[model samples]
Target: MKQFPTHIVAVDGIVENEKNEILLVKHRDKEIWTIPGGQVEIGENLTDALIREIKEESGIDVTVNKLVCISSNTGTYEGYNGYGIVPTKVMLGFTCSFIGGELSVSDETSDSRWVSKERVLDYITNPNLIERFKAYLKFDGNIQYIEYITKPSYDLKLKIKI
Candidate 1:
């Protein structure tokens, strides 16, 4: 019998401004546009990891409002392929309130900006990226569970509030 390794835990923040726009960051290395977040280090709390990641990537302060959804990539999303062939990531998504900070980019992020719901598609072309925001739009203040499958397309999303 073999022991399975621990799954990587990640956090994504949906930071919204007074204009009702969401913040997205472009990965400096990957060039992929997604919500600001990263892997949670060992011994770090989920929310704390989220705050640190957002600030590190976007240089902004945010107050975590509520958990939006919990999703498992299960080798479907290639963006988290940093671990090589074995892809397993549990992502905790949260709705955040923008506190204050000047727009700045970190080494991990090439660009950071706010995008309206309608204009999100213009910046993010990845199906997985688009689906993330769409899931948030349908968020009804309930926790959503998502499982992604990339067969025909990246739209294989199953979101259910439990």
Candidate 2:
């Protein structure tokens, strides 16, 4: 049997404010706080998808600033339910400016808030989130990426020299 080729395109917006705080969505799936984003539709550009997902999920309108990160990873989510079965996603991350929107919850989100870099540490133990946010916070907003080739095992295809 031939292996199937399935690729899902996803976009995540790192919306930052003048105070350097980042907007994060408290997912209804788990207790993790992640950026607002979703799958990029067929024939749709990456930026357009990020814009749409942020609005839909977090009620936040965004103006994409830059491709801060390009992460390529293949991993199993173990018990992750939202995007199921054979899961392989290509996530395009962009830095964005918050234009205007009210804080609201969607089916996918439990809560949404603008958090300071300091607060991210308080939310540790949420899987690999600590490391992920550390990269974004430590840097001077200098776009980067963290690719996980095999999760569940915490394996990565690209290694960062720390």
Backbone clash tally (model 2): 0
Off by over 4 Å in 2: 1-4, 76-84, 124-132, 138-145, 160-162
Model 1 Cα lDDT, one tens digit per residue, 92-140: 8888999999778998989999988678778887666566677788888
Among these predicted structures, which one has the highest lDDT?
Answer: 1
- Best candidate, TM-score: 1
Point out the worst 10-residue segment of candidate 2 by lDDT.
123-132
Q: What is the C-alpha lDDT of each candidate?
A: 0.82, 0.73
Off by over 4 Å in 1: 1-5, 76-85, 149-157
lDDT tens digits, residues 1-162, model 2?
A: 898887777888778877887888888876677878888888898888888899988898889987656565677454444646656667766779988988788999889888886775665454334445555555565655666755556665663532
